[model samples]
Target chain A: MAERAQRKIPDSSRRSERSRRAIHEAALALIGEVGYAKTTIEGIAARAGVGKQTIYRWWPSKAAVLLEAFLDLTGEAAGAGEVGGEGESESEAYAIPDTGDLEADLKLVLRATVDQMNDPRFDVPSRALAAEGIVNLELGTEFVRKLLEPQLQLYVRRLTAAQATEAGGVRRGVDPRIALELLVGPVTHRWMLRTAPLTHEYTDAVVEYALYGLAPRP
Target chain B: MAERAQRKIPDSSRRSERSRRAIHEAALALIGEVGYAKTTIEGIAARAGVGKQTIYRWWPSKAAVLLEAFLDLTGEAAGAGEVGGEGESESEAYAIPDTGDLEADLKLVLRATVDQMNDPRFDVPSRALAAEGIVNLELGTEFVRKLLEPQLQLYVRRLTAAQATEAGGVRRGVDPRIALELLVGPVTHRWMLRTAPLTHEYTDAVVEYALYGLAPRP
Candidate 1:
């Protein structure tokens, strides 16, 4: 509708899509450069080469714009197969592969996650959002709901499949929701705190430790 | 030296100690209320009813002051035995008790940690520092090194004790540093992200899952 009011382009839909993508990239880049506190919708609009009205028409607030952009960035990484080569669509990008050999499959996905987290593109903007989220309850909840929870659910599905008595990975009574934390939490913590390096070797160890556990296996 | 120059009370040492305590309290309160950016030495001094010079004489920067005050607050909490009844001294406050059963000890301390993290006195200011630390690379590194790593080392010691042939807790060849992450990482993530409620039940579950792991036990 807005495009129709503007000068004619090659294709309205393609033009709209391009503008949408530019906004996402601009929002992420602005936040990463200036930090979340200073990032504004106007700055994003200026960077994206779009009018502020266009952003406002599409998204309600700067946070909405930034968070959606954040998710889209991760989606791009997923499409790049940074997390897994199988991802093609938005929904598909969120899904972890299940090869039935749960350990190998989980390891494969987690290593890819490590690679994604390590990518400066994802890491920079994410740190800005995460830092802001820690202090802002509403934004943090939205972040978890919109961005983090969806990805976690994919782990839930994969783990749930493994819980099948016939397939046999997770124990029957084990809750996938809680189980996913052990797999994901360590990596997230190390990345967030910079307490340790996020290496393939490190992620592989996390997977092994989480699968087998600390207690001596009898 | 400054105390000698000022009006002396019945006991100068007691007066100095009182001023020091007030400064710590003020620093924590100011940061928690106004956030790290707005918080300043003047603000802390004003709230504490001390000379700004006094604060500067003791600490080089507001961050240094705030972090030390944070450690003191936790020390006070440790003295209260919120984590373990055995705590008294500063070092003792950091130590995890060895009741021979590693799981019980870890769970006890973790439950205490959950309690501490939940305490508004600890939680509010911590959220500020944690948020700041996430974006500020130098501050984040100092936070992990000075505050978090010490607590983690206690776990390492406790787990190391368990790894003894006779004690038999954490399996041999399992790195304690990595193992500690599995236990601490989940609780930290949930707390930092505000993704879920921080309850004793949740932490107990974390301790259990971390000990046993995801794969179906043989």
Candidate 2:
């Protein structure tokens, strides 16, 4: 009886995992198509081919589902590189590379950012969420707290490490927190405003200009 | 008869100007109240106490009305400082001051930006418009071209002048266009994201960090 119970438990857990993935995919797709204001738990459940109660059982709100969906998507995108080697932890996939070259490291991540921003899969849904964030202060704060700041902190960590290294790339007094903004902010502005096309070339230019200073270096 | 006709024409022109101002004010108020999607031409016309044809004659669409309304508001804001001098041209209001000190000039402009972003008269309608821009690319591009890029170019020109005046202050090879972003991007990021409060102090910090380099100057 004990052996039978153990076997049933693994099957149930696998089924639950499948259902969760389906719900996340459904939530992302629905929000992309209809936008945040119109997306609902019922809609996600319908699209996922599951009952609404099953969705409710897992997530209390559409916002919660969408948030997790984005987190999952980011994880998957980060996992595409060699960081996802077998036996590596999940956190490894999201880790920003630390090569001790601040400029090159920033450029590499930003180039990947350019790709992600341009990708329709990411862009459409992100725009939907961003539009909602602009109007909804509560959701916007939650997004910054949960999604954006965590990613920004990875840059902060890298910059802090750069300061400690003896190579002397960044100035000692520079605050890594604000320094990261000089790198990330421009790309974000171009992306959000559609002022220009965001490309790897553009991202590379931002990194170069930021590191070298705009005033002619004496 | 010719003199009488000319005098009558001026009177009619003066009346038209008043009506135009009323329409602009109405458009801003309505957009702020109902947001972009719900705001309509008929609504603006009603609020302005003008016929739909009058608004149609002046603007092609609601977006056009809102954009021009904002332009008119900015013009008024600029002219507020010009009250004592009849010789001041509209161009003077638009020009960023070149005080031979880049950091001071940047701080002045960014402080103005902080004030503009915080002003309820500007913030509510601007937020409504920005939210729409996030979702509508064609509209977003048009809005940025008509309203934002002109303002950004002023910074580019000022930065270029700074580079020329103080050769060692900015790198010669730096693109002023991209370089200006390093200054403006962080301010906008903080404002739009609400990650921090927008203040003159924050603007000063951004200018200092951007121009001087985050690293302690050698």
Identify the leading candidate in terms of lDDT.
1
lDDT of each: 0.85, 0.80
The RMSD (Cα, Å) of candidate 2 is 5.3
True contacts kept of 1: 0.81
- Which residue pairs show backbone clashes in model 1? none
lDDT of 1 by residue, B1-218 (tens): 88777955478788889999999999989888878888999999999999999999989999899888988987876665535445464554557778788778888888988899999989999998988888889988997888888878888888888898665578888999999999899899999998788888788888888888778788
What TM-score do all the candidates reach, one by one? 0.91, 0.88
Model 2 residue runs over 4 Å out of place are A1-10, A81-93, B1-12, B78-93, B166-168, B215-218
Say which candidate scores most in DockQ. 1
lDDT of 2 at B129: 80
B213 Cα displacement, candidate 2 (Å): 2.6
Candidate 2 lDDT score at position A128 = 86
Task: List DockQ for all candidates.
Answer: 0.74, 0.55
| Candidate 1 lDDT, A149-192, residue by residue in tens | 88888888888888875655788777788888898999999999
